[model samples]
Structures are given as C-alpha cells and as structure tokens.
Target: MYNIHWEEKALHELEKLDSKVSSRIFKKVESLKEGLHLSDIKRLKNSDYFRLRVGDYRIIFSFEDNTITVWKVGHRNHIYDRI
Candidate 1:
C-alpha cells in the first residue's frame, strides 16, 4: 500500500464537506493508495500527478515512489486552470 498525505488545501476543502460525504471521499482516496494504475494517473501530466473524481469534488494529487500526495480538493463548479 502506498502512503497518503494531504496538503493544507485539500484538508481545508475536506473540512467544508459534511461528515458522510467527507468520509466517503476519504475512503475512496485511501482505496487508491492500495494500488492504482499509472495509465489512469499519468493523465495529470508530468510529476506523476493525477486527479480522482469523488462525486462533485475533485482530488488533485501526485504519486512518487510508494506514496500519494494530495494537493487539493475542490468542487467541480470552480474553474481551475492549473493545467
């Protein structure tokens, strides 16, 4: 299993969600740590970054070695030109 670390931005966004939604999202993210495809993740471009969908929220992260670093968590309604 890969280690998972959440950035301050992700943690902050997580706090904005209701307990049930937040818990479910966390579970999905943790599940990915166990084993996820690089093909699925590589779409994020360089730095081994990726984004996972959880309902209306988006999880931006990166995988390095045996760890996953969550960079941000945000609603789909927002515009993020980070790409």
Candidate 2:
C-alpha cells in the first residue's frame, strides 16, 4: 500500500471543482491505495511527475518512498501550464 499526500495547492484546486467531478477524482485517488500500477499513467518528460486522467481533468502527482504526492489538479488546458 502507498500513502497518498495532497499538496496544499492541489487541495485548493480540488475544492474549486464541481462536486461531482471532485467526488470522482477522490475515488480515483483512493484507488491508488489499492495498488494501482503505472501502466496507463503518462510520465511528464524530464520530470519525476506523472499524470492520471479523470474525464477532462488531470491529476498530477509524484511517487517516492511509498508515498504519492499530488501536486496539482485541473482541467487539461491549464493543468500543464502550472506544472
């Protein structure tokens, strides 16, 4: 099992999303605790970050030492800009 941590900025971004979208995102994050692999995850070039897709939004995170740190959450258009 991996511990999931959310950066303050990521949490704030989530809070600004629609409730339904937020709920789905939460569910997907929780699934990471159950041992999800990185087969479908897209790695950001030249970075330690990876991305998980949830509908039109994206979850940007990094994994290290049994911990996953979510750095940002936003729609596709602006998510990469912040990263």
Clashes of each: 0, 0
Which segments of candidate 1 are over 4 A away from where they belong?
38-42, 45-48, 79-83
Best by lDDT: 2
Question: How far in Å is the alpha carbon of 65 misplaced in model 1?
Answer: 0.4
The estimated TM-scores of all candidates read 0.79, 0.94
- Per-residue lDDT tens digits for candidate 2, residues 1-83, read 99999999999999999999999998898788867584657899999899999989999999898898999999999999987
How do the residues 1-83 of candidate 1 rate in per-residue lDDT, one tens digit apiece? 89999989789889998998899779988888769853434346554567787777777888788988888777767614543
What Cα-based lDDT does every candidate model obtain? 0.76, 0.91
